[model samples]
Target: MKVVTTEIPATSAPPTLGVLLAGGLARRMGGGDKPMRSIGGRTILERVIARLSPQCSGLILNANGDPARFAAFGLQVVADDVPGFPGPLAGILAALDWTATNRPEIEWVLSAAGDCPFLPRDLVARLHEARARENAQLAVAASGDQSHPVIGLWRVDLREELRHALVVEDLRKIDRWTARYPLATVMWPTEPLDPFFNANTVEDIAEAERLAALDDAS
Candidate 1:
């Protein structure tokens, strides 16, 4: 299905539901949720929420296991619809399904890694602008030459197709599926720090602390 890009003014982009993809195994960071890991005294997930909440009409957490662990955050936590810890694509599919069921009026959903604390403030606006400008069904964020497939805006209308890719076709790689669509890429500067920078290891957390200080100073 071709998604007609909404021509709303960039500043008034369509109401978007933000989904935090936190359903990772985190084996590299020693299992458990990496977003829960603290950076500069605040949990990564807390910082992620702070960055994305204002940019979205509503926000939900895509996580597995017990929802009560995220209770203090006061956000609705939805689990992946595709089982076996299929990865971020599964998380994205779950977010699309959730938005379709709960917020049917919203046609777009923006997803970001929960472990990414430095998400740009202009994330939603820029993605929408790029999608409209390119007339693409999907928009993914990029820094320099690297594209972040999971950090993207997805059309809610494409949820069924995504589910088919995940369940029937067993497609797990995000880029592989996104390759089939008319995808727009919005690039951001990596000078201060890549806005999509995520903490995948203990050392990365320390680096995030230093970067967080840099971000605060700037």
Candidate 2:
């Protein structure tokens, strides 16, 4: 299927449902919910909500296993339709499928890694702007030289294509898939701690404590 896009709305950004990608089996963080780990006296998931909730019309958690694990977050948890935990693309596809079925009026899905506590407030606005400016098929976040594909804007219309990539082609690398279309990478500053900082291991959690202090001071 062709990956096409319509003109972005010039008015306020369209209603977008934010999907927090938390379907990972975090073996690096001892195989549990990394976002549930605390930082700055708050769970990382709480900080993610504080940072991302305002930018979108609604939020959902994309996770596998028991939906009850994220019951406290009070989100509509949607697991991947495809089996075998096919990486972040599966989570993205789940969100896209949910948007298509439940919110046909909403044309966009803003996806972010559940572990990133310091996501930028301007994420939705900036991604919309960059995608429109570049006339790109998608917009992803970047800090310094790194690209955070999991944290990005997805067109709901492209759900079928994404599903094909994940299921038929078994594509796992985000870059390899995104390379097929025009993509805009919105760059963020690393100073004062990168807004895309993610905690994956015990040591990273300690570093997050330090960054949490810097995040509060900023």
Each model's lDDT: 0.89, 0.87
User: How do all models score by TM-score?
Assistant: 0.94, 0.93
lDDT of 1 by residue, 155-191 (tens): 9999999999889999989999999999999999999
On lDDT, the candidate that comes out on top is 1
Candidate 1: global Cα-lDDT?
Answer: 0.89
Root-mean-square deviation (CA) per prediction: 5.9, 6.3
Worst 10 residues of 1 by lDDT: 1-10
User: Which candidate has the top score in TM-score?
Assistant: 1
RMSD of 1: 5.9
Question: Across residues 22-140, which tens digit of lDDT does each residue of candidate 2 receive?
Answer: 98889997799888899999899888877777788788889888888777777789999899988998999999999899888899999999999999988999998999989998999
Instruction: For candidate 2, report its TM-score.
Output: 0.93
